[model samples]
Target: MTEVDPLALDLPVLASLAGSAADEFLLARLRADGHEHIRRSHGYVFQRLIAGAPTVTELGAALGVTQQAASKAVIELEQLGYVERSADAADSRIRRIALTDRGREVVQLGRRLRAELEQTLLATVDPADAAAARRVLVALLAASGGLEAIAGRSVPLPSD
Candidate 1:
């Protein structure tokens, strides 16, 4: 007869641990060298901006966030001088958001920190195992609709 251990079958335990570890790592990297006002969601925003500068509406759509939420993020970013917003020449009503020097610096710092963190975590991990895990996570994210691009929005699990 096979023995079933509750701890081995506890999903919540695994989830809690994973969430805590991720939160700690994020906090460390974001706060690394006195960095501030950056959150996990900003990673996605940065990626989108790198692909190309986008209007707030376009950013919202690409990010899967509402226009208001996107605008609010832009406003905060603007206030921090991380990004600059200017009226579009072609469409005066629309505003274009671009990363400023400081924003770019923050993004680079974040990238370096993340890379270092990954290096630390993968120090002892077999390269094949790490590659597999990365593939699995990418697949899961895509399968899960790639997460909402905005804040305060819920992405339902597959069971629904």
Candidate 2:
């Protein structure tokens, strides 16, 4: 008879703990740095903007939300001076949303913080283990239709 480690069966729990640690770290640091208005929800917009400037409709599609809801969020973020909306150069009738200087700064800060957190966590494990874990995560993400699909909505896990 062979014994299996109980912890080995809790991949979801382990992943959640790892993610929560990074989220808490960013939330605390951002708040301390006087960015109290930003919320995790805002990250959706921020990430999309980082990929490319998108119209409200496009953002809505990407985020799996209605255009009105996406527009409301954009308006709020615009008021906070984190994002700016302008007429599309190629399409005067279309409005595109982009990150303002402040928004860009916040995004850069997040990137830096995330890198630092990764380094801190990886330091506790063997380099090979960390690399292997990353590869697995990448594979999982790819298998699931990539980040856009995963970001758009939450679905119940399939029952075995």
List TM-score per model, in order: 0.69, 0.80
Q: Report the lDDT tens digits of candidate 2 across residue range 33-69.
A: 7788888778878878887889999888777788998
Cα-based lDDT at residue 49, candidate 2? 87
The numbered model that scores best in lDDT is: 2
Local error of candidate 2 at residue 108 (angstroms): 0.3
lDDT digits (tens) for residues 1-160 of candidate 1: 9997656854445544665687678767677666666765665666666656789988888766788988888888788777888788899887788888877887888778768878987998999988996786555555655544223233321121
Error of 1 at 154 (Å): 16
User: What do the candidate models score in CA lDDT, each in turn?
Assistant: 0.71, 0.80
Runs of candidate 1 exceeding 4 Å displacement:
1-20, 142-160
- Among all candidates shown, the one with the greatest TM-score: 2
Error of 2 at 70 (Å): 0.3
